[model samples]
Target chain A: MSAPPLPRTSAEPLVPVLAIVGVGLIGGSFAAAVRQSGLVTRIVGAGRQGGTLARAQALGLIDEIVSLQQAAQTADLILIAAPVGATTEILATLQPSLRPETIVTDAGSTKADVVTAARQVLGDQVGQFIPGHPIAGAEATGPEAADAQLFQGRSVVLTPLAENSNASKALLTRLWEACGARVVCMEPDTHDTVLASVSHVPHLLSSIYMWQVATAQDSDLRMALAGTGFRDFTRISAGSAEVWRDIFLSNRPAVLAELQEVKAALARAEQALIDGDGAALEDFLERAALARRLWGSRSGLA
Target chain B: MSAPPLPRTSAEPLVPVLAIVGVGLIGGSFAAAVRQSGLVTRIVGAGRQGGTLARAQALGLIDEIVSLQQAAQTADLILIAAPVGATTEILATLQPSLRPETIVTDAGSTKADVVTAARQVLGDQVGQFIPGHPIAGAEATGPEAADAQLFQGRSVVLTPLAENSNASKALLTRLWEACGARVVCMEPDTHDTVLASVSHVPHLLSSIYMWQVATAQDSDLRMALAGTGFRDFTRISAGSAEVWRDIFLSNRPAVLAELQEVKAALARAEQALIDGDGAALEDFLERAALARRLWGSRSGLA
Candidate 1:
């Protein structure tokens, strides 16, 4: 049985100044939840768009807007919540201003790239960085879509750097716990492969299927006839294009591998249909239906 | 703006006797809805399993259990809600017993085959048959899973035969409208092609994706980390294997045609990923996202 979410604790904040970079859905939601829990004294948000950063502050997702360097200098903990492709540059800019005792973590969906970025930019201060990917979010984006309960009953995976200590890992774990997330620790590469099969490839395939149907000659008629099942099956394709594009590029190898596997499976299914092999096709669908039926309960998503 | 669901016209019934061929999700729900609308004096259910039929009667989904011939002799309206492949045989047996004026309709997912079966089995009385596909269902099946409101606000597509009179079409349309469905009439081939693109291919793709993920060595870990989006995207894959197999096999040509279209799109997306062409990938995803975002509002599913 699963344990209860959120442990009892005092009202003391986790860090004096918590800085968030790229204040979009992930960063904004993290700020809202941590701020609601009073686990940080101030949330300083930094982003490429000055307007978006200011709006994040106005929405109370952040206490102020600042430059990446300024945030690195003042904050005790820095959260990089940018897309995976931008993390390398963000970490590079923040490296020069970081103090040795300060902790840094990121919320990118693809983690191996973030680890490589840390290795290149943070220099010897890489020990302070803990790479993570929160298994949460919807197709919606921005500060306006932020919710304090976004991470409740969700899992956050942390992939600590070789330079990290046990105390730093504990501190980061506690921080996520305060936000009501069940934290798991795994190697960055393992996280990438697992997520490729479970999330990234699914997103790509859904988008691909949607593109196939949407650009077809009878798309208007097809769309009219589509019901809730079709809607649910392809809803993830509506996610932010830039974010998904980055994920596809950053996690290309694993995504490509899984796509090949699916292509092979679909070929067999198509052949079974052409051959009029009802028994063979039923066998194929049987395995999937049984597996998927058993998945909902064990899959925390339910 | 749409009007309220059911009219408050009369305690009078719509049909004196309504017969359901298979007392499952679609047929049982039809029984419940029409009965609640006070639109049927007697509901007769016929299936292979006497035990299941008894349960349906206990649940009030049917007022009596009868043989197909008996139902044909008495019921003014006979609803063939069995699986698609079985409908041909069912219609053949019911034809000899069916009264000349009796109206016969079906609730199959695939229609071209049903139209052909009606043409072959019901002979000159084929004019009484209306081939239909209700764009509503849940992951659940069986009589116990039936709901009176299943068809409310949903679309019901009817593909009538050339022999069908205006009166026959109007009667089927009115019966569905009274059950709160928005009815649309089109050619049988048009219905099959639209459904092949919208429903059949999505179900097949989802099952293949699930099979791909579940058969992997790291399936346990992948399932653990999967989120609600994954669940919703793959939910249809959990539907009955026999039902889906019949759908794929019965609608092979159109399903294969659509699958080829999807394969081409997937290959294109994969190429963009391999080329690291962010702009191309973004363009591909942008079209899908825009189409899907707009689909929910126009789609009855939303």
Candidate 2:
């Protein structure tokens, strides 16, 4: 179900020097897990000018914080875990210092945009850039929230370009597996479309709904009356604004397309209510209830 | 703060006999809590012809399973926790046997429709019926999911009729307080409108999104890739289908009104994406993120 098993020999680290850019939740957690697995000799973290990189170092999530160029020069593997919007700039910065053998991967939510950015900047060196997305996230952020078990039993999607060699793909796949993730391969466009339907659109719609309710005239009263359901439904809206903003913009095409479908679905529901069609309404709700219940049971998230 | 501090006297049970019309999550929890509080001598349950009433009795949440008429004839208070669609029929059955002093209340999600149904069926006895919406819920249902502390530290909103005496209002307030819930009062229309903004619309929208995705051509792939955000956002869709169906229909006007506003918000977001207006998109998301984070922190739900 996953890539070939990690090619390991006795007592050898999988990565000699690992570099993580944007040491936030995903990056920090990857460092923690890989370190815990004893699969990396050293972890260097680079992030936007802030205490996050220092915090990651302090929390033992990384060996040190360095400049992007320094990280690229010294690293055997560089993982860009920043927001998708910053991908092109980060790639451009890394291109000059990047060694031919140093493989690069990312943890962005959108794949196609990141792939395009990598191709535009890396050019002939793009073969070393393998795109990835960890299908794991939480509302929490920063180094403090990173856990060694963050990616345990989770799926990590790798959308490798045609230029990539099997060895480069296998290395990243092995790294993700070492962090306890199941690696799956997908086409970049399909990955973007699928993720847009399930993740990007849900995030945007949740934020839209939250914004509407929070800015309404009776917002105070409405907030006071909201309960567990409202809390859970809007929980994702509390995520990092810059990160999600980048996601929605990067995956705009698929997201806008799915939003049309969601709008159509809402219109049908509204029509059922306006027509007072109890049978139609009940049938609709029942289908949703059944599907949701089945998924919850199967996913163990009920 | 909570109805004259429960109007208590030392060592005396607040209610002698309590009747729960539907032995589901809300009603069964209420029975369990009141029984544990020693505020009731007996708890009788009546539900749609099924194993639910018997199951509630077996779980010690109810002392007996009886007909609605029997419950009306003997109980000091009757709580109709059935779906709103069943409220009228249940009220009609209880009206003939309802004692003048037997106060009636409900745990429906919508208040205005429940109020109208009570007025239609209970007629002159409408004074006995108090409309309420509990600001607590879980995806689980039935007696098995009932917890005595389900309402603890939760808000229970009551929309009292003009016909209701101070004594009747005070009794329901005291009952909810005994179950560790803070009781608040609102006009029937106001309660419906507020809940429409927070709870009802979210549930309907979540269900519609879930339904659309679950029925899509690549639903299996989408579901496979979905993570925690999707789970939390759509958890409410797994609720009782009949219950939510009735909630949407019963609260049609308010839900429809809220849906219009939600559509407008979504349209704005769609336009922002189309124009690639990063500033506008980020601004919209930032506002929602701020509001959601504030609410989550203040509500201790973060």
Candidate 3:
């Protein structure tokens, strides 16, 4: 584990002081990725509880464990990789020491909320903040689960405010690319809506389905019979409850809209079943299958 | 493919004669499984379409492609692996030549429909029919996609009618086991309900979600950005539209009921999002995640 031999040369200018807030899976991963890339000269991580910081540093996820104020004061980039709900307080803590040149970005799921929180804490200086979400993670959590390769082949969505400097945006984009992510620029609200449909709502659906199965009278038998299909359908349900709960709350509207649309489709199929409308049910299934096939084929997922 | 080298000993006897009635993915796989298990002396396939029969024979998916009457006349087991809607008609065509010892089963997704269809066509001889579903398949279709190992490590749910003999039940169970499936017994209604909740509803939800995305203004962009999360969530949507449509129709009530429940949950999430209730959203996501994690872990998926 002594740093799997560097995969690439360290040609880029060294990031002198890098601060990662809430060093769990995402934060830890960012730290590891920076280390792997050989682009950061020094990395410091700040966590609410000292234990996480200690563990992160011990695991080589960070070079130093420091206070939020200390990390904020010295770091070139202060990355808020905490749960969406925790961003506001973390931003507040970093405000006094916020340097004009310090690029503040986040790896939160929801963008608008993080942007709003940054605006409230740092006002016009929010221009230094780039609201970004790296669409990558495992069902597992904590620094132990962090892998430098987590973001590889993944997409990172960046929501840059109008006032954000081109240099800041370019740097952040390059960093993500260096981490092996395909970067896409999106409007903050649009990103939330799209993500809710694609990620958050699906998580909720998986959880509800699992709950239904768990509550069944023959839960043990059902659980034993659960195979790859069930596993795949429920993978997202294994995500951190605390983090997901916050995400659901923060991005409820889009999730709900997507849920409603799915429900209507389900209801239509239900009516067909009750009425013994084989043709109608087939039609619905066909449409669904077609859409999925097209999307999957187009996405190189088929 | 020179019969793909049968996996079982040739010495095993009273080898059943299996008449596979579709010779596509399910039927072809069954034919291959029968050959691989050395549990069937002959795997004769009956398909109305000439191309399927040709492909099945050419791919060594079947020993012979026979007419429905001929297959029913000589086979010890009649596996109606055709579309659910076509099962009754196929049963009717095969009934005239069905022997008293012939054990008929199916690979239908929905049991209740197939059972009902069997009762209509076979009457008192319905006792000879055993409704079964192998919860195994890939997105790929046709004889070319059939694999003898498809059922390996998969579950095969059997719903024997009240009148079915223990001998027939045991034989059907053995056949599935020979195909490398772990067999489970359940009442037909219960099987339909369980599958609807776990499998059917998920497919419908995936399709609806895919439809939403596919129909979006930036569908290409969305599709391009689609990652493993979307791919997994919508995997079932890439399945055969015709086959899935029939399943939806056949098991509409249970699927609809499940859909209603999911819809309610999704609607709640939507309301929370609109109301900007981060706590509520978080709670929902956490609950879902916990349920999924518990089920997934218990199922050996996590």
Top model by lDDT, which number? 2
Estimate, for each residue in A1-302, the C-alpha lDDT of model 1 and write its tens digit. 12234334547666889999988888999998888777788889997988879889899889888999999899989998887888899988988989888899999999888898789887788899989889998888888888888899888999887788776777778778778999988998899999988899889988998988898988888988888789888989989998898898898888888888988998898889999999999997999998998998676564
Model 2 stretches astray by more than 4 angstroms: A1-10, B1-10
Residues A1-302, model 3: lDDT tens digits: 01122324576554778999988989999888878777788999897878888898889888888888898789999889988888899988888888888999999999888887888888978898999999887788899888998888788999989988877787777678779888889898888888877788677777766666666676666666666666777777778877887787777667676667656655665666788776775666676677777666665556
All candidates: CA RMSD (Å)? 3.0, 1.4, 5.1
For model 2, residues A56-152, the per-residue Cα lDDT tens digits are 8989999988999999999999999999999899999999999999999999999998998999999999999999999999988888999888898
Task: Show where candidate 3 strays beyond 4 Å.
Answer: A1-9, A257-280, B1-10, B267-283
Model 1 clash pairs are none
lDDT of each: 0.86, 0.90, 0.79
- By descending TM-score, how would the candidates be arranged? 2, 1, 3
lDDT value for candidate 3?
A: 0.79
DockQ of all candidates, in order? Answer: 0.79, 0.86, 0.45
Task: Rank all candidate structures by their lDDT, best first, as comma-separated numbers.
Answer: 2, 1, 3
Model 3: residue A88 alpha-carbon error in angstroms: 1.0
Using TM-score as the measure, name the better of candidate 1 and candidate 3: 1
- Give each model a TM-score: 0.96, 0.98, 0.90
